[model samples]
Target: MKVLIIGLGSIAKKHIAAINKLDQSAEIYALRSNPHSKSDIAGVIDTYNLNDVKVSELDFVLISNPTSEHFSTLQQLVEFDIPLFIEKPLFSKINEETQSLVDEFEKKEITTYVACNLRFLDCIKELKTILKDAKINEVSVYCGSYLPNWRPGVDFRTVYSANKEMGGGVHIDLIHELDYVYWLFGNPDKTNSFFSNTSSLKISAYDYANYLWTYKTFSASIVLNYFRKESKRSIEVVTDKGTYYVDLLKNTIEFNNKCIFASQKRIADTYYNQIEFFVKNILIGREKFNTIKEANTILKLCMKD
Candidate 1:
């Protein structure tokens, strides 16, 4: 298969690696803005101009560019009628223009899938199954990690995650919790949020974000931050039966202090599985794997004040 990737950043590299693992013979092409930027990964052809890409000959296009450029990039490629695999947090901000673009995709029946690989995590999948028919009461989600330690040997201030203009805030950056919350429980009747730069992290983006979503029978709270000495990502859910704790960083699930499920899987496994699923979905002509509309709904919730 011939795949075109628009950006050669870290996330793009993960996708490339995942795709390669699934199909050893897949031809990979990258469209980068910086002509000087090159890929160290073997078999990746780098093209500086979009005109050099033959959309008709490609199996699909993956948008792994900065969040700020996703809208324009999608606009440029949407008319080509090629399937799209966009990285998470579909847009930095949603507006009429963005909505119109979404409408255009729907009108054209474009096959699109927005990446939210966390949904494919082994522990998360098990949690979904356990809560499939349980009576949920309340949920608490916390995700915190130090920004300076995110990428070793790289300046934290230089990345897009540190700039608000590039969509680097904790609210949008750690949107996986919100996506899975919606996936497991559907939309909330109301949402309240607070996003601000509460940390000394030398970045222009908000380093902290908190959200409360209210449903008919339950409520969920999500807290995200970029300045914590020790990294943590976990979820605690209260149900009629008991409370459940999920440690994403540890890949384990527990109920009332008793371990229920544990997986020795690395986080990279989710990325690989996600790409594998997307490839199979495309091959079988399935278009319902995390559609743009579904991602947009989560994006809208993130923007709520």
Candidate 2:
């Protein structure tokens, strides 16, 4: 399959790797601003301009550019009718124009899948299964990591995560928590959130955010930040049966102080699985997870005040 990737950033690299692992014969083409800095990664053919690409022969397009550029990129590709594999959060912010584009996608019947690889994690999948029949009472999700440590040798202040316009805030950048929360529990009856640059990090984007979602019988709270000295990504769910602790970093799920599920796989595995699923669905002309409409709903929840 001929695949066109719009960006060549870290996440884009991961997607390339996943695609390579999934289908070695897949011809990977990239449209990059600085195509001169062409990728050394095997199986990738870099193009200096979109005009150089044969869009008609492309099987799908992966929008892995900055969140701020997603809309413009989509605007250019909207008429192509190619399936899309968009990176998470959909956009840095959503507005009526974004909604109009979403409507166009629906009107055109585009097969678009927004990335939410966390949903493919074994631990998360197992937790979803366990809570399927349980009466949920409360859920607390915490995800934090030192921003500077995210990309060694790179200034955290210079990265997209540090800029609000580029969609670098903890709430938007770390939206997997919100995505999976919605995946597990569906939409909340009411939602409230507080997010701001409450850290010493030299960034314009909000480094910390807390969200509360209320359901009919249960409530969920999520805390996200980019300034924890020690990395942590876990979820605690209280149900009628018992509380279950999920350690996303450790890839383990525990209940009643006993371990229940452990995948022991690197987080990249989930990315691979997600891409595999996306490619498979594209081949079958259907997407079962994180469609643009579904992701837009979660994006609205994130942006909800």
Candidate 3:
């Protein structure tokens, strides 16, 4: 399966690296929209023409480009009819314009998948399975980091995370929490979200986002921040009888049952795990990853104010 990756940005490089690790048989090709786009991938020859991105030659495509143009780009791919694996926060922001296009994709029954990398993530995956049928008393996740520290080489001022037009904010940066909340528990009738760039920092986008979901059976709260000394990604699911914690950095799962216990060292790469799932669905007609429609719903929910 030949794979074509568009938008050779920071995330695209990681996706390329993971793809190389997952499957060697699949050929990798890279593309950037502008001839002047500064790409990080070494030894890669980039061409600007979209026609050069032959949808027929490639079996799959990863649309990792900045979201301001995702709608038009996606519409072009819809015409091509090849399956797409889009990254998180499907659009710049949810609105009537994007909703109508999403609805049309559903009606045509196109084969599409969205990248909620954490869904197939090893640490998160184990925790989801262990707590699938269990009771949840509380769910809280902490996702934060010093923006400048994200890429040790690049200056934070130049990154997309600090730009609003590129959909770089706590809402999109830390939206995994929102997606996983709905993944673990069903959709909530309502979600209240408040966001701000608390420090009045140099950045124009939000630095902190706090979301609260009040459900009939249980309540959930998530705090996402991009201003901090240390980088942390952790989730704690508290139940009636016990609690579970996933230390993403450590890639370990530990459950505190007092007398009983459960834990595992994660072996799968989250990126590859999700990519493998998507590839399997394409190759074998299996429902490995979340559908495009399901991902769109998650996208819409995260856009709620």
Candidate 4:
């Protein structure tokens, strides 16, 4: 299989790792906007000049660019009819241009998938099974970590997450919280959110955001931030019977004072599983990973006020 990755950022590297692990014979190509950004992965990744590579030549394309540039990039590639595996949130925010591109995808029946690797986490999968019959009332989600700690050598302020215009913010960057909620409960009926730059971090984007979403049967509260010294990501679902907690960081779950789900596997396994599933199931039309249309719905929910 021939695969082309449009962005060579950290997430793109993970996807490349997953792809290589899945199929050793697959040829991997990457397009880097900055020549200086090139790393010494020549044998593993064949770097291509964006203008020289035709979209039709690849089996599929992975769009892992910064959030603000996603829609414009898609507009350029949507006509190719190749499968697209896009990174999450779909866009920084929805606008006419984005909606128009979505409409084009719909019209084209594009084979598209959006990345929401959190849904493939062992704890999250177990939590879904536990909540299948529980009477849910409220769901609370949170994810926080120091921005500078994300990429060891990169300056936090220089990344897209540190700039609002580039779609750098706690809420959008940690949107896995919003995505899992949508995956578990579907779209919310209404939503309101508060954003703040409460941290001492010298970034233009909000350091913290809290979102409240009301559903037909329950409500949810989600919080994300980039200032926490210790990293944490978890979800708590309250029910008439009890509360179930899924610690994504620990890959464990507890319900009614009982240890229900626990895993010792590396969290990176989720990325592998997600990519494998997308390739084996989604490509053959056996199952659907998160689709672009569904991602747009989640995108609207993320932007709700």
Best by lDDT: 1
Using alpha carbons, what is the TM-score of model 2? 0.97
Cα displacement (Å) at residue 122, model 4: 0.8
Task: List model 3 lDDT by residue over 1-305, tens digit each.
Answer: 67788777767777777777677655767777677875456545566776876668887888888877788888887777677888776888777878788887777777788777777666666777788788888888888878888789888877778887677887887777788778878788678888888564578888889888877777788888888769888788888877887777666666783322333434236777667667766545746356667877877777778
Residues forming the 10-long window of minimal summed lDDT in candidate 4: 39-48
List lDDT for all candidates, in order.
0.90, 0.89, 0.75, 0.85
Quote the RMSD, in angstroms, for model 1. 1.1
In the order shown, the candidates' Cα RMSDs to the true structure are 1.1, 1.2, 2.7, 1.7
In terms of TM-score, how similar is model 3 to the real structure? Answer: 0.89
Per-model TM values vs. the true structure: 0.97, 0.97, 0.89, 0.94
lDDT of 3 at 12: 76
Off by over 4 Å in 4: 35-39, 45-51
Error of 3 at 240 (Å): 1.4
* Cα misplacement distance, residue 21 of candidate 2 (Å): 0.7
Q: Which stretches of candidate 2 lie over 4 Å from their true place?
A: none
Tens digit per residue, CA lDDT, model 2, 10-78: 989999888888888999998879746778788798898888998989989999999899999999999
